[model samples]
Target: MRRWRGRFLARLRAIAPRYPPRREVDRQARADMAASSVEGGLPGRRRANPSMLPRRIPLYRELIRATFQPE
Candidate 1:
C-alpha cells in the first residue's frame, strides 16, 4: 500500500506543470513589462483632463449633450 501511494504521488508530480519560483516569476513579469514599454506595446495612462472624461460615464454623456446642442 505504501509503495503504491508513493508511486502514485511520483506520477502526479511528473505530470504536474512545473512553475517557476515566486521571485523568478515576478522578475520575468517585470522584464516583460519593461520590454513592452520600450517597444510601445503597452499604452501609458491618459493625462487627466476635465474636458476629456471617459465616454462610458453618464456624467460625461450629459456634459457632451449640454456642450453640443443641435440647431
Candidate 2:
C-alpha cells in the first residue's frame, strides 16, 4: 500500500509543481520519505507512521516522472 502510494505520488510531483515553491516542496518531500523508511518492530510486520506519508504519494509520482521522462 505504501509503496504503491509512493509510486503514484512520484508521478504527480514529476509533472509540475503546484503548491508553494518546488525547492521547498522537494526538500520536505525527501525528508518525509526518509522518515517512512524505518524498520518497525515485530517480524514480517512493518508499519508506516502517520507522518511517514507526508511525501509518499507526490514524491512517488515525481520520482516516476523524473526517471522515465527526462528532458
Candidate 3:
C-alpha cells in the first residue's frame, strides 16, 4: 500500500505545471485573470504589533480567555 501510494503521488506531481506562463501577447489576458481572481477575493486584516495597536488588547484578552477555558 505504501509503495503504490508513493508511486501514485510521484506521477501526479510530474503532471503538474512546472513554471509560470511566459509573458508574451497573452500577457494582458494572464494579468487580468490573475488580478481579477486575487483582488476579487476577501479582504484580509494584517496584525499590527500588539504594543503599537490598542485594538489588540481586547483580542489578546479574548484569546487568553479561550485558551484557559475548560473544554
TM-score of each: 0.24, 0.27, 0.25
Give the candidate order by descending lDDT: 2, 3, 1
The C-alpha RMSD of each candidate to the native structure, in angstroms, is 22.9, 9.8, 19.5
* Residue pairs of candidate 3 with colliding backbone atoms: none
Model 1: per-residue Cα lDDT over 8-67, one tens digit each: 345334433443232222333333433333333212233344323332244533433343
Stretches of candidate 1 exceeding 4 Å from the true structure: 18-71
Taking all chains together, the TM-score of candidate 1 against the true structure is 0.24
TM-score-best of 1 and 2: 2
**lDDT (tens digit, per residue) of candidate 2 on 1-71:** 36644664565465545443323345445434543443222212435445544435566557544544535
lDDT of 2: 0.46
Model number with the top lDDT: 2
Error of model 1, residue 36, in angstroms: 51
TM-score for candidate 2, residues paired by index: 0.27
By descending TM-score, how would the candidates be arranged? 2, 3, 1
lDDT of 3 at 24: 21
lDDT of 3 by residue, 1-71 (tens): 34434553453344334422222223334234333333333222233333333443355345333433345
Q: Any idea what lDDT model 3 has?
A: 0.37
